[model samples]
Target: MSDVFDYIVVGGGSGGAVMAGRLSEDAGTRVCLLEAGGRGDHPLVRTPMGTVALLRTRLHNWGFETVPQAGLNGRRGYQPRGKGLGGSSAINAMIYVRGHRSDYDGWAAMGATGWSWDEVLPYFKLSEHNERLQGPLHGQGGPLWVADSRTGNPLHQRFMQAAQQAGFALNDDFNGERMEGLGAYQLTQKNGERWSAARAYLLPHIGRRPNLQVHTGAQVLRVLFEARRAVGVELLQGGHRRQLRARREVLLCAGALQTPQLLMLSGIGPQAELARLGLPVLQHLPGVGRNLHDHPDFVFAYELPTLDAVGFTLGGGLRMAREAWHYLRQRRGMLTSNFAECGGFVSSRPGLVAPDLQLHFLVALMEDHGRRLHRAHGVSCHVCLLRPHSRGTLTLRSADPLAAPLIDPAFLSDPRDLDDLVAGFKLTRRLMQAPAMAAGVRREVFTAGIETDEQIRAVLRARTDTVYHPVGTCRMGRDDGAVVDPHLRVRGVHGLRVVDASVMPAVVSGNTNAPTIMIAEKAVDLILGRSRAHGASMPAPVGAGADVPA
Candidate 1:
């Protein structure tokens, strides 16, 4: 096998898949994508309902657990990251949310140049091929497929109705003119199957594109640098250590957790941390793994007698069999459900600049990310703090590259986060009590009989965990502490860049997968030195000023 390539992409996750696909489109650029897990072609990955199987097993999941969080009564949080070709997209719920426009605008405001809503919207449109909604805000003929849920579950509409009855507006499109109302989510699916990043971008052109090489089960150990410039990567592939040289660049797309870990392992982190670990420091960038944050989420679970809700019971088992038959025959059934099918963005309090909390109404009772199962029919409402002030760290537990990094999200460490969550809990409780939902509700299970601010605070402290959108470790900004600059080039280094969720300056207002994909779409232009006509005509400087809300 050839040892040299024009570009070496680490981690075949959302960002790496996009990078490998787009860069290799030139035909001249040889791109090598290394994935730590298998090809991710299992049936459990393709079937939408199979997310349950994938989440329950460690086959294709990293399944990393965090250090006991002081904010959550010293309880550890579960983090299930996809380890295969498609990464988390393969195992994720397939909800397609681009987050609020204000999210990107805020990034630009924080000195992440060329990342404002106006500047990055083109990229969002560029990567999307929406099967239903299309116009200025969306695009057609793109690689990624975006479609509405085909499940046609009554519970989805019920959730929307409940939210509206509770006074929230009905929004047909969250990615359109407004993002503040409840609605059914679009999904990254095609023909009732999960169309993960690999399916959308990499898998199609695998054998077709000779310049593109994909290696599964190749775990990158470290970036090999010459003086200051990254030149290659050392990886353990097929039980043998292999060195592959990158003639041009090494792109780290290992998502939030591992990207920073890889950087720190490669001697590109805080000097003191490296010294304490007795590792040689290649570059002392203090921001390598700092500014770690995620949406602190709490689920309000309930039990119901209605069979309309999904659960594990004799009746539910029969329903699943029928749904399976329906899926196999027509590709439309409850099996197509993403579970968190309907949700919305809202403020915890009135008249906020933007929504500080987001809701994800589920068709089934989800406790501990579906890890805990109940035998009765039920439902759940997930409320998460959109912009958490609490921050944490990702540090090496040991010098071993194979060991999991120490993840401390410090959820609710900021007292304000607990306050926001309390307000959100009250709002969600009101929504759940709406006529549409109250009709089917039997009893509240999680925070039952909980009332008053102190009671809510106690519930939040016990239940608050990640909504799976972790970012900002290798933050992009113009500040010296920033690990990557506005262009995503690693600070104090050349021929190296971070192109993933880890580069987000702050967590977005909603689901993060869509925004991460958009980052890669825009990153292609930045890497190739090509100016996007859609973005180039904008009047604002990339990071000059804050965007005034219209």
Candidate 2:
């Protein structure tokens, strides 16, 4: 590997992969990407349904956990992060939603400069190769492949019918026009398999560019700095630890959780917290782990008389067994389906401008993957109160570099979050009871048939978990204690930047993968001295709009 490069990107996840590929495009600059996990050589990751193979596997995932949530009946939530090349994008459900325009507008209203809808459209368009969007809002010439899932299940149709029965218009596209109805999800897939960032962005440029180097299984321990300016990284590679320099810049794309952990480990975080950890304060960045937030998701399930060909269910084992046999023989049947085949988005109440909540329709029933929900005969329509009102956080439990940090996304810490979720549950229940699904869909089998709001709240507290999208740990802004600047430069430190989801001042209303990629693309432009058009024709971010601030 080259001793120095024009830029060093850490973490070969979704954003990191894209950044490395995009930044190395000109060939005028050399770039090296480092990942804590191994190469993207696994066969399971290539399949759409192969997420199950990588979900719990250490080969491509870091199974982290949060401290007990005070709002969720004191239950701890399970956090799953991608450990390999593509990061969580390699293990995600692959749903591709760009989120709402207001989400961007809200960012502009906040202090996050140039992140308004108008300003962000180019970046989204740049990362997207859309099949339908043929306009100014979206572009077709991009590396990331965006298309509908090839395989469609009839159960999904029935679910959509149910959603319509609940009075939601059949939205053909959530990423287009308005994002306030139920529809089939567009995925980040090409051909028939999962199109991971590593496959789409990294691997294509790995061997062709000699200046670009990729080092996998290289765990970064901390950022090396001199008088607060980050100059290099200390890493553990091949069983031995070493320090590597970045002649120009060191980028952190290690994601929300690890990015904060690394920052705190490197002595950059809240002063009091660092004092407790007995670490010297390299930088008194209070926001290193503050404003930690995530969407707390809940699943409502049903038991159907007829079994599905490809829904995730424990009781459907016999049918899945037959389906698995068929898949092995001809690559067909239920085994080939991703459990979340169809879904919808809508406002929980009437008269809302955009969708306040997002729902995912499913043919199979899913219990808690966090602590394992009991398998029963049914289907589930998962609904997440995406535009949550609550915010929690991530902080270092100990200073040990090898130890996992204490993450408490104080799930539903705010009462408003509960109210919104309750409204969503009522809407979801209405959808489930719709005439469209009356024949195929069954009764609500999961919630113990509870009726009262208090009971519903109790159930939600017990069942609500993360949809796995976490951001805003290492927030970017012009604030005094912010970890990174608007250009993604680390505060109080030069030659270093955190370029992952953690930099989002706030979480986007939709899934975070796309926004994270957009951040990387925009960050590259900033590093290359190109105009990002930030603060141009856009408003600033809002009140602790303290959301995907980056």
Candidate 3:
């Protein structure tokens, strides 16, 4: 491989894969992608049930932990980011959600020009190939496949039924016209197997494109610069140090947590902090590690009879053996379950403009991001505040590039966020108590006798953590506090950009994977100067920015 290229994309996750894949489409330009982990096509990543194992292990995951959070009674929160080529998409739940339309509109409102719902809707459609749904909203024949879950488990249906019985509306498509009701989620899958960003964009074109070179296990130490322009990157591979140059640009898609850390390590951050660490400051952008926030989530777990749901009992073990065979033959069964099979969006109060709380219903008991295990059959539901008012920061632990960043989400620091979570607990408890789901209930594992608001608040303070949607460390906007511009370019640097969830001005109202993919799709156009022409026009979203169906 050559030492120089037209573009160098760091991190082969959702955004980096798309950037490299799209940039290499022009045969004249050379593109290189660097990933810190191995090829993400492991059997554990391909199987849908592999996510449960992936959460607790570092095999394909960067099992990162936060600095002790005062919100959760001073417990460190778990953050599992995907390693390898597919990034988090390889290890995530595979739920395909584009957040609310207002999320994009809100971005534009925050000075991220050309990022309104209508402006960015075309990119969302451009990256999707939905097998079931078709319309102006969904796309066909795209690289990323979006389809319904193959799990025929009735528990998912029962959860939705219980939601309906609790007086919530049924939303067939969360990514369609509206995103505010109880229903099953569409996944990023192909014929019941995991279809990650690597599979969709980078994998098939690896050897096919002579200009595209992908390197795994390449840990980038820092961005190489000439004066102010980002020229290349210094990386560590096989215990050897090397430098690769980018003739056109260097893109950072290392995700929210690591992206900011990289920026700081590269001498582009708060000047005082950078100088305090004995690192030279190239740009004094205070927003490099500021505005860090995430979905503060609390799970309500229940122990139920070992029926169709998965458990650790002898019968469940025997059933899982049968399921393995069933999955091997037909690619359909309990093994195909994403665990978070059912969920929806709802408002905690009457006056909210959009659904403020999102839910993820699981068929098995989960605690601490599946790190804690139980021996009984169970069900779990997660309720997370969609947009948190409280913010935190991501800072360097030391000058060492390999050291993990000190991540402080400062969850629930804003009392209103805690208030909303308390309301969500009450609301979720109601759904669990409904006749459809109530009959199967054995015992509430977490909140058994929690009744009053004060009790709910206390439980929330003890158990609240992240739903794995951390964002906004490298915020995108036109203000000085913004780390990147509306075009995703670094504020004071040339030939550099950030094209990942880190650039989101605020966390969206749903799972972040799909939106991260959409960001890359649009960023490709921006890099090619074809932004004005590529998918720039489409029918306006139905009731754009309006409240979802009640």
Candidate 4:
């Protein structure tokens, strides 16, 4: 193993895995990937139903919690970040969504040059190997494998039918011409097993490419800088402090929360904050942690007397045991369920350009991110405001790199966000109460009998938290407040770049995993200075227009 490489990628998460894999494709270049967690090869990580165990336990999760949120009546929010080779992708629901076309176009409009829908669609196609869908919108032979969920639970179809019964259209493909309506989600899986970013990009090529080095349980303390240029990284591995140099560049792909925390810890944050923490300032970038935001979500749960929902009763336990055996033999059954198997995008009101709220109809009674479980068979539907108006900040609680950062998403700080969520709640309740869904429902369990707008607002304040899509901390744009520029390079530094979800100027309208992977795919070209003409290019979706203000 070499101490120095052409590219040193920090945090072997979604983007870092892609970076290491793509950069090392050039046999001439050497790449090193650092991960804070273990190899993430546990059977729990490969099983879709294992998501519950992963989130509940600290095995592969960072298990971060936010400061008490004023918007949620001073309740601390739970944030479970993935720790290991694949990062959050290894622990996520496996839903493969690329957000709406407007999301990328809006980025270009906001001065993130060369990131329009037409410009970025190629990267999305390049990263995906969709088994069911094909054509210009999807790729066939790609690293990331995406397939329809293999869960045979009839409740998934019932949720879709219920949405349609409530006057919503049934959309077969949310990633197609339209992102509006109800349907089953395409998952990042192959043969009923979870297919994470590491699985797609790094694992297959590990020993085959000697130039690519992946080190797990290597925690990066800070980026080492010579004056204003990032030269290497200081990390702790095997109870020993060590340093690794980057011959060309040091890429930070540590996702939203940790990326900003890393920058601040390395003295590249607000001058006052750094000085107060008794840390010398390397470069003052206030936006390193200023634009923090996530989709504030509320879940409506109901108890049902049916075996279709996952539970812990005697019958349910026996059924799960049988399903486990079935999964071992056929690789399909209840164990193949990604709990939130079916969902959709829809608007709370008419005349909206795109859906303002996204729904995840789960086949279990989920509350507090499934942390607090119910002993009965039930179902849950999550409604989240897609594009929130409120913004928050991430600051260091202490100079200690191991200390959790001060996460304040300030959810619903803007009055309009609350209003939008109220509308979304009413719409979700209507779908849950529709004839198709009502037939399976024994009774409403959470937020039941809440009809008034004020009551709904109260419920939101009490229950709303993150739906796991956190971005925009290290914003990318051509503005004074932007932390990274259009090319994802740090504003006041050289030989350094952030190629992850943190660089998003605004949160996308859907799941962020696929979009983050796309960012890495496009970043490979930028880092290598390759032209779009040489990469996979496709015509823009018909009727897709210029960017609009988000």
Candidate 5:
């Protein structure tokens, strides 16, 4: 392989995979993709149910932890990021969601020009190949596959029934004309297997495209700069230090947490902090790691008598044998379940511009993010504050490139977040108590007797953590403090762009994987100086507006 390339994409995650794959499509362009993890084609990654093991171990996970959070009663929070080519998309629950249209419009409103709902809608359609639905809102013949959940679990119907009984509307498609309703979420799966971003974009063209090279287990130390222009990257691969040059541009898609850390390590963050860490300053961008935020989530778990949901009861073990046999034969059943089989978006209070609270109804116990085990069948639901007022930071834990970054999500730092979550908790509890759900429940694990607002607040502080959607650490805006420019180029530098979740000025209203993919799709056009006049010129369909906020 050559030591130089037209483009170098760091971190083969959701965004980098797309950037690398699309950029290399031009036969003249050479692309090098560097990933710190593995190839991401293991059976564990392909099987939807393998998320249990993936989340619990470092097998295919980064398994990062946060600094002690004062908002969560000083407890450290768990952050399990995917550690392979597909990144988090390899191990996520596979629930495909493009956040409310207002999210992108709000970005353009915030000075990220050409990123409104209408402007970016085409890229979304361009990236997706919906297995069921197709319209102006959804694309066809795209690489990333989106399909309805294959789990034949009866609990899906019960959850929908319970939502309707609780007076929430049922939405057949969350990514369609409306997002405010309860329903089953589509998955980034195909024919009952996980179809991660790498599976969709990078892996297929690896050996076929001689111009594209993918190097896994390559840990990037920092961006190599010629004066102020990023020219290449210094990485550690196979226990050897190597420097690969980029002839055209270097794209950082290392995700929200590590992207800023890489910037700070490369001497492009707050001057004082860089000096304090004994690193030279290239640019004093204080906002490199300043706008960190994620959805603060609380889970409600309940124990049920039957073996319908996933669990470890004696009867459930026998059922698992049958399930395995059925899965091997037909590729369906509980084995195909993403656990978070169904979810929804809804407003925490009336008159909100968009759904402020999102719910992921699981047919299994997700106690401590599935770290804690139970011997009984149960159900779990997660309610998260969609757009949090609170923000946090990701800083260098040490100068060591291999060390984990210091993550302080400052969750619920703004008391209003807790207030909204309290309302969301009450609303979710009501849904659980509805007749459809109540009939199967034997006991409520937590919050059984909690009734008052104060009690809810206490439990929330005791249990709230992240739903794994962290973004905006490398914020993009026209403001002086923005880390990257509107086109995602690193300010004060040439030939460097960040194409990942980190560039989001505000976190989206739902699962961020799809939006992150959309960002990469839009960025490919920006990088190549291609006009949106061709395939990506579709406007947002009628009635695709947010239910509340215009």
Candidate 6:
């Protein structure tokens, strides 16, 4: 309640909200959470399909875009970051995935001594409350809700049928023991409303917790350090600069893009880059904004008659009125759908550890993101490199916190990554033209007309874009190039922790919201000296210069 608190968390996004909620549980500990954006009060943000309305809502979103990527023939990649209480989780498609077990095990093997699949699984299980069956892999009483798809488009069922006919086994659970098949995806929703991190964790506790203070519309300018120790945070509050002290630690949950930018603003990054920003270098950690990765997808669409009651486009105006009646009267209809409906996981090539490509089936057939209406009735199949090989960086463009950081996703930068993408496109095409999809589909619109590899490559070169999953900016590692240690603590900086997607050592093979939440959940256990009884494996301290898992 005072100027100084036990913990000062920066950014009230997916991870920060979880940390603030969990760590503030102790009556003796005081927590302060600062969010740059306004409260998530926008009506669109709360609606089940509010992302469309929120996409162009700049007041509630950062809406950053990447620099012209040479790999994409000098095209700028669009980025939609949530600028509200829930952060991107509020605007995301709401898919829930824990990534592969080997993802964490590899962290342990990389010098992050205690992190393994076995250790992290408990934390994952502990954070989720699956609406359906509860088992060893799932926990029932968790704060976060993982609900099954309440409604499915007819096209979704057909996509599965096509996958089944194409020889890939059908899998109803991508987060189960096996993640290498096609099936319906579980979303982070309850009924038809999105249960974002802020809504599930922070909101319920804010009213009753006296020790926790959440400050919205507060932009952190820098982390205050004394003798290389993070002691507090300096922020702009209500047009007035206010300095808030943190007695124990300053946690950075500013997401992947902005966390490193904040650190650099406080003089913790490449010496040359810092010097260019006119900042006094506190530490020369070159990896502060490096190792950025994401999943880039290329979409395929086919024209449909738009007559089926169970398919998309049927939810427009007249149908919307009918659906509104159903939802208002009984809470049923297309209003419950996430729209990017059902999808599956598949391997782009053989000999890989897990599925390398993820497919998203959508009934809407717009060729580009946030674009004009489709010329005709249609649906689309989006498939791309699940875990791309290309890497990029985000660097400070100016010393001012208001200045946007320079983002370079470098999509399809690697020739190998492009090759994998081409393979993925080929496979998706096979599924679309198969008997299952052909049953009621009239004709192909987007790529249905393309027959050769050259034509398909042209489509990808012009339109392949990100699936909105970005990670690895502040990678955890034993190497000097890594920005953070295995426990998500920043290297060369004491009492400062990076608690978001930024600390991911590598990009998970799917949507990032779930893993980001898992990171925060596991970090809470570590801070409390507790480990999840099931999936969270905590490691002992490793040498600073040795390998570490984050």
- Write one digit per residue (lDDT tens) for candidate 5, span 212-292: 999999999999999877899999988999899998889999999999999999998988889998999998888999999
lDDT of 3 by residue, 53-149 (tens): 9989998999999999988889999999999999999999999999998999999999888899998888898899999999999988889999998
lDDT of 6: 0.81
**For each predicted model, how many residue pairs clash, with residues at least 3 apart or on different chains?**
0, 25, 0, 0, 1, 18
Give one digit per residue, the lDDT tens place, for model 4 in 82-182.
Answer: 99989999999999988898988999999898888998888898888999999878888899999988878889778878888899998878899999999
Scored against the true structure, residue 64 in model 6 reaches a CA lDDT of: 90
Each model's RMSD to truth, in Å? Answer: 3.7, 4.1, 5.1, 4.3, 4.8, 2.7
- For each candidate, the alpha-carbon lDDT, in order, equals 0.88, 0.77, 0.91, 0.89, 0.90, 0.81
Among all windows of ten consecutive residues in candidate 6, which has the lowest summed lDDT? Answer: 541-550
- The TM-score values for the models, in the order shown, are 0.96, 0.92, 0.96, 0.96, 0.97, 0.94
Local lDDT at 137 for model 2: 65
The window of 10 residues in a row where model 5 has the poorest summed lDDT is 541-550
Runs with alpha carbons beyond 4 Å of true place in candidate 1 = 532-550
TM-score of 6: 0.94
User: Which 10 consecutive residues of model 1 have the lowest summed lDDT?
Assistant: 541-550
Instruction: State candidate 4's TM-score.
Output: 0.96
Off by over 4 Å in 3: 531-550
Give lDDT: candidate 1, residue 492.
78
Model 1's lDDT to the true fold?
A: 0.88
Alpha carbon deviation, residue 506, candidate 5 (Å): 0.3
lDDT of 1 by residue, 389-446 (tens): 9999999998999999999988889998888889999999999999988885778898
